[model samples]
Structures are given as structure tokens and as C-alpha cells.
Target chain A: MAPKVEHEMHYRRLGRNVGLGLSLFAFVAIVFWLTLAKVQRGEPVEAFDHTARPSLETQDSGN
Target chain B: MSDASLQSNVTTPAGDAGFRDFVALLKPRVMSLVVFTALVGILVAPNPVHPFVAFTSILFIALGGGASGALNMWWDADIDRIMKRTQKRPIPAGKIAEGEALGFGIALSGISVVMLALAANIVAGLLLAFTIFFYVVIYTMWLKRWTPQNIVIGGAAGAFPPMIGWAVATGGVSIESILMFALTFMWTPPHFWALALFMNDDYTKAEVPMLTVTHGRKSTRKHILVYTLLLAPVALATSFTSIGGPIYFAVSLVLNLLFIRGAIKIWRRDEDEAQADKYLAERKFFKLSLYYLFLHFTALLLQSALGVTWGGF
Candidate 1:
């Protein structure tokens, strides 16, 4: 539990933060664009093609 | 070739790279399993997540898992330092400080939960948050110190990833998701017990109350056999859901049979016999258990991809 002072970690910390932030931002933008596309096409963004489970559709809707 | 020559070649001694230590605290190996199971959960769901959103969701889920590892390391530093296998971890080895790991884990826990909520759905976010809390608070801080059933209850925390992954796409739980969760939950005890049979001394020395330490190796072997037997039915049950198919059933049936055979072998061995064979049953069973879950999930994913159903769906 000894407190180690920051000495040689400047660039490493900065690079790690920047990389994570950029990845998050890029993914957020892509998800937003996809959502918008679904909106434009008049589809529910949350709705999925449940073609394989035609029987489950009624159960899903009932729920 | 005296002091002057050595001085001329002086190089700056670099401190340990904090990033790698940070990643170590996250327990990348366990994080990979979390990511894989969560991915399978998403892929096997009847509803598909948007690829971009799914990627983001999985990343945050992995971070949540990593967050648990960090906090667990922080809390278990004492026991970790005592055990030979864990003595070299970031916190115990002094590669990273205690306060740093605690702060890092707390920050990532908040960030992952919030971002997952935004990118996916409330259910997935809430489940991820619960998973972190369960691991760090309920399991690591409590059961692990007090009881031998720690792995049994704490296993639920690791079991949540697939359920969260399913929630990310469907925003709700289903039989398939529940079965996936059950599969991991049931598989954990036997998998870990096999490891305990080999590494019992470490747990005993640390006084960690592992099954091998508290219940005796014979009882631990019996528990492993029972859990493996229980796991087989659950693994097969998934094939009756949206995720299961002929391939999944075939692979899982064979794997389960082999696993049962291995468990029985372990159950019958005594300490002397185990020593005679170099704990061969435990070691081999442990290795097979790893593949047992992976192949079952892999077969599930294959069936999901091909949209193959044996009239179950």
C-alpha cells in the first residue's frame, strides 16, 4: 500500500487515456449514425428481424 | 574499462511501465473469457445487436470485468501476497500501488456502467453494474474470507456477462440467455475444483477457505463430480433454445460424456494414488474443462450463425 510518486509515467498515462477516449468517441459516432439510418428507413432501432422465431414473435408481442 | 568507461555508457533506468501493471490488475486472461462469453451471448440471441453498438457494449463489459479484477486484487492483496501463484501480481509485487488500483477500478466501474447504459440498454448497464458490485463487494470482500462456498456464489458474478450480452441486444432476458448464464454458473465449480486439487497447498497456506482447504480433498472431489453432472444437463438444455442446434448438441453430448468420465476418475483417486499418478486426473480434467465450455459455446455460435434449428426453435 505504499504510495509511489509519479516519476516516469507521463507519456504512458496520456497515451492510454487518449487511446481509450478516441476509441469510445469513434464507436459512439458510428452507433449514432446507424441509429439515424434506421430512423430514416422507418424502422425501430431496437426492433430486430426475428424471422427465425415466427412463433416467438407472438409471445414477444404479448409480453 | 574503469569508472569513466562505465559512466560514459550510463543509461536512464526506466521505472516499470504503469500501463502494463494497470492491465495486469485488470486480469486480462479472465477479461478475455468475459469478452468471449458475452460475445457468444449477443451472437446467440434471436435479435442481433448493431455491429458498432455491440463492439462498444462488449468493450465496456470487458472493462466492467476488468474493474472487478482490479478491486478484487486491491481487497485480496494480503492473501494474494501469501499465495505463490498470485504473489507476483501488480499490487502484491509492488508494481502498482494500492491506492492507484482502487482509484483506477472505481473510475472504470463508473465509466463502463454509464457508457454501457448509453450505448446499449438499461438492463445491460444495470446487469454490468451489478456484476462489478457482486464480485468486488459480495464475493471478494465477504464470502471469500468467510466460507468455502465462495466459488459457488461468487461464480454468479462471472456468469453475468452472457446475460448482459443478451440484454444488450434484446433489452430483456429469455430462456436462451438464462441457460447461457446457467451454463457458466454450473461449469465454474468443477473447473475451479480441478484447479484446487492441483493447487490446494496454496489455498491452505493462505487460509482462504477454498473447498480443498475446508472440506477435504475427498469431499471436494465429490462436489466436482456432482457439479459436472449437473452441468451436463444445463449444457444440453441450451440446445433446446434459440442458440442450440444439431451441431451444438452433438459437440456438447460428447464433451459432457468425457467430462463425466474425467470427474469420476478424480472422484475415485486418493491422495496417495493422486501422488502416484502426479495428480494426473485433476490436471487433465482441469484442461478438458476449459475446452468443454469453449467448444459448447463455439458450437452454439456456429448454430446461431447458420440459423440452423433441429425443430426446437
Candidate 2:
């Protein structure tokens, strides 16, 4: 068989795939950093749980 | 399938779109201005943002701006194909499909708004959403072809970035934020009108109802001078606000004088004179207008960085 050769189109496709991957990775990193900063600033970080939490109880009572 | 046949099958019209074409769809040049003004908005706020939060918020804002750019390009692709200035854009150039551009815009719009809200605050997110809507729906879809004053009112979309940035930090609006918005809002008319004076053929060919096309170049020149006259006070008045300082005042005074001088030269000329000089005064005024806005914002950034104030206010 003839030696397989890489074409210019393959390189362009590779480049686009790499760019997309990097953008996604950067997005994840940004979200992680934002979450870390918010937590460090002592802003409340709440996720829905089936049970009641003290933080929500206090916020609701205050409101 | 054979490898050669597979390669040929994959080479469709839309298959040639590279990553850069997609970036081009985002209008990186316009996004840079959005990023810069939004950064200024964030930095000059009375309250400080966490560096990471600020960074993320600005990224999302730029994304939102880019999203709107994509949407604008998609909607305006028909006129874009007719305009000399826009003929080489991704859609008109056939590098990207129009449907692809629309989907890309909608996806980025949703992501940017939601992420900004999560990264900054609800106010910032809502402002971003409104800005996107104003640009895409109100400006591009509705006003752009309907009236000669399209750019006059449409400029509000571009002016909202700093306010959004201010909201990111302060979680609300204020006089300072409003002033920054006003500065851009007031400056946009002359900046675009100057371009219209030079690129009159583009608007004419595209039938976009630009002031120059509808009212004539002489009328456009008069409008430019009138708007520049109005712009000077707004630029100068920003200096007395909380964000303003001695440096900003000095910068604004000098720039406004040059701007008015250029506008006067433009207003005084007839088409015969302008044609002889290739619209030199108008082109020069256009170039100066870019620097005028950039330097004003830079001055505000300097005031914040140097911790200086005019002491009078």
C-alpha cells in the first residue's frame, strides 16, 4: 500500500477540533474559578436538596 | 467507502468553514470594543469585584456581544451581500451557512446570559439579555432599514456594555454608569455618520436608508457637525462626575476642541471640495472619533487607577 499522507483539509479539521476542545476547557476553568471566588467571598452557595436547610430557613424568616 | 470517495463526499459547500470563519462570525473587532468598555465599567465602579468574578463576567459579556453580532450578520446577510464593506463577511463569502450562524448565535446568547447571571448578578444578566435584544431585534431587524435615524437609536445597544459592567459590580445603576452610557450614546452618531459620508455608496447599494443615502451627503455633514457639537458637552460633563478627575478633564477638553474643529471643517465643505480631497476631513474626523472615545475611557480608567479626583465635585 502507498504511504498514507496527511492532507491540508485534515489539518484544518484538526485545528477546529482543537480550538473547540480548548474553548470548552477554558469555560470549565472559568466556572470553577467563579465558584471558588464566590465561596471565598462568603456568598451563600445553595443547591436544592429535598430537605430543609438552616440557611434557607434564616433567609426566609428574615425576608 | 473508498478513502478518495469519502474525502470528496465530505467536501461540501459548508464543510469548508474553519474555526477562524466561526470567530469571524462573532465579529472579533466589535467584540474588542465591547470588552474594553465593559472592562472600564467593571473597574471604575464604586465597589470592587473579585478579580476572577470580573474576568468571568467580562468574558460572558463579550460572548453576549459576539452572539448579537452573529445574529446581526445572519439577519443582515442579504444587505450584507449587497454592501461593498460587508461582501467579504463569512455569510456573503459563502464560508459559513446562514442557518449555522443563526444557531450559533442563539446558543451563545443563551450561554452568555445564563453564565453572566451566575458569574456576576441577575441585573448584569438581564441587561445583557436586553442589549442583545435591542441590537438584534430593535436595531437590526426593525429600525436599520426603516429610518435614517436607525444608527442614532441603535447606538443604545452598544452603549449598554459599561452599564452592564457597572451592574456586575454595583448590582445596580447610578449617575456614573449613566454618564458612561451617555458618553458612548452621544458619540456614536458622528462616528457612524462620518463613515456614512465616506461610504455613501455602500449604504446606497444596500438600500439601508442611511442618513447620507436618504437625505444626501450635505445633510449628513450638517448632522455630523450638530452631533459633534452636542457630544462635546457630554464628554466634558463626564469629567465632573465621581469617575472624573483632573486628567480626564484635561483629556476631554483637548479632544473635544479637536473634534469640534474637525466637524467644523467637514460642515464647511461642499461636495465638490470633498470630492477633490477624497473626503479627507471626513475621514480624518472618523479616525479621530475612534481615538476620542478610546482616550476618554482610558482617562476614566486612569482616574480610577491613580485615585485622583477634581476636588471640585
Candidate 3:
């Protein structure tokens, strides 16, 4: 077995990986915050749930 | 060679793109302009947006702008290689492949539009989508190489950010947003033509058919002055709108006078004089055009912040 040494290329690749990881993490955080804000504002957080709901019907009719 | 060395060599191929290379594909400078104008749009709107929502919406808008830039780089790679000014762009520099840029652009465009729709409203999402399409398809693909009026129409893509920001806040368009659009739209030709006057060789080398290249420098200079004359009214008209105030009006009046003065200077210089001084007047006008827009937008932001109204209007 031989000792492995780090190369300059390894540092570059690591930096890129860290950057990508942080970007994805930030994106997820934004989505979470947005959902929280929307819910807090009392806006109906509706999505296609594959089942009918009276709330959606009432909201649609109101609109 | 040792096994570790062989493995490292295999993993890090020559010219492998770093994260910065991908960021370069986004054209951060242009994105800053988009972010600033869009932030002004959000802040100046009649209705207020939640701080988080505004932040996310702006992020998505900037991403959309970056996507357009990537697509533009992909499509313009051939011309970019020929032009000295654009020769070091990501695709031209071989840091990123054209197909990679295309895919990256497409993916970001979709994500930004969908996220913006969820974060703000559908209208903002659609406007961002249209901006991306206009810049990539209408401007970059069609208008750029085909006509001298390329920038005139292509400028609309750049102008849409504020409108989208207003839509994010108000969930619709209004007179203020339209005026903001008009301000940027009318200002583009003169800004770009001033640049064209100074960088005439880049367009000539790239066969881009700029006003200077197609219509001749003399005509281009005349066009700059004419557009500046027309732009002044639009710039001033915004001062009378709801977004306008004493500060905005005062700022706009001074900037417009300076802008028009610079344009007249550009219009007056012949090639002999321009060559003697290396297009000093044209260069100064181009630099002032930057401050001209920045100050105009900043003044609008100030008006919103001060909550002042134009009593004359």
C-alpha cells in the first residue's frame, strides 16, 4: 500500500462539489421558506392530491 | 506511475470545467443588472411582496437571465470565437462544451420559471419564460445576425425584468411597469450604439451587422443622437408617473441633459477627430449611459423609499 497525495485538481474538484452542494441546499431552504410564508399568509396550499376536496371546489368557485 | 497518480489523472481531464466556469456561463454582470431592475420593480409596485417571496422571486429571475445568457453563449460560440471581446467566454474558451451550455440553459430556464410561479405568481413566471425565449430565440438566434435593428428589438428581453418584478408584487402589469419597460427599451439603442461606435471592429470581425457595420459610422452617430432625443421624453415622462417624485424628476432632468449633451458630442465628431482621440467622446458617452440608467433606476427606488409623490402631476 502507498500513501495517496492530494493534487491541485483534487482541490478544484472539491471546491466545485462544495459549491454545488451549497447551491442545492440553498434551493431547498428557499422552497421551505416559501412554503412557510405561503401557509402563514393563509393562502390555500393546494396541489393535485389525486382526490377531490370540497375546499378546492369552494376556492375555485370563489375565484 | 503509481495507481493513485493514474486515478487522479483519469478523474481530472484536461480543461475539465470548474464550478466557476459554469458560473461564467451565467454572465453574472448581466444578471446583476437584471437583479437590480427587478428589485426596483418589486419595491416600486403598488402592492407589497413578502420579503422571503421577493428574495426567492429575484433569485429565480436572475437564474432565468443567466439561463438566457448560457443559451446565447451556446448559440453565439462560433461568432464569439471570432470576436476578440468574446473570445474568452466559457464556450469559446473550451471550459464548457456548447451542448452542455445548451442543456444547462434549458434546465435552468425550466426550474426558474416553475419556481417563480410557485414563489410569486403565474404572471411573473410567464413573463420570465417569455424574456428567456425572446433573448434566446428572437434576439440571439434570429435578430442578431440578420438585421441592423437587432439590438433595438433584442433590448426588449433585457427590459422585461422590472415588469416581471412588478408582476411578482402586484400579480399584474400596470402603467408604472410599462414606463419602466419603456425607459430601458428606449435607452438600449443609444447605449449599444455608443458601444458600437467604439468597438466597431469586433462586430465587423464577427459579421454581426451592427448599425455601425451595416449603415456606416456616420449614420450610426446620427442614429445615436436621434435615439437620445427620443429617449429623453420617455425618461422624463416616468417622472410624472406614480413612481416619480421631486427627487426622481430632478435626477432625471439633470441626467437627461447630460446624456443628450454627450450624444450631441458623439454626433458631432467625424472619424478623423475620433481616430485622433480614439473615440474618446464615444467612450465617455458609453460610460455615462451606464450611470444614466443606474441613476434613473436608483432615483425611482428613492422615490419609493421616500414615499413621495409628484405634486405637479
The candidate scoring highest on lDDT is 3
Native-referenced TM-scores of chain A, all candidate models: 0.50, 0.58, 0.57
In candidate 1, which residue pairs clash?
none
Which of the predicted structures, 1 or 3, would earn the higher TM-score when compared with the native?
3
lDDT of 1: 0.85
Query: What are the DockQ scores of the candidates, in order?
Result: 0.13, 0.32, 0.36
Ranking by lDDT: 3, 2, 1
Give candidate 1's error at residue B122 in angstroms.
Answer: 0.2
User: Which candidate wins on DockQ?
Assistant: 3
Ordering by DockQ: 3, 2, 1
Local distance difference test, each candidate:
0.85, 0.90, 0.91
Compute the interface RMSD for candidate 1. Answer: 10.9
Candidate 1 C-alpha lDDT tens digits along B212-266: 9999999999999999999999999887776788889999999999999999999
- Taken in order, the candidates have interface RMSDs of 10.9, 4.4, 4.2
Local lDDT at B308 for model 2: 76
Candidate 2 chain B minimal-lDDT segment of 10 residues: B4-13
Score residue A61 of candidate 2 by CA lDDT. 84
State the lDDT of candidate 2 residue by residue for B132-198, as single tens digits: 9999999999999999999999999999999999999999999999999999999999999999998
Reference-based TM-score of each model: 0.84, 0.90, 0.90
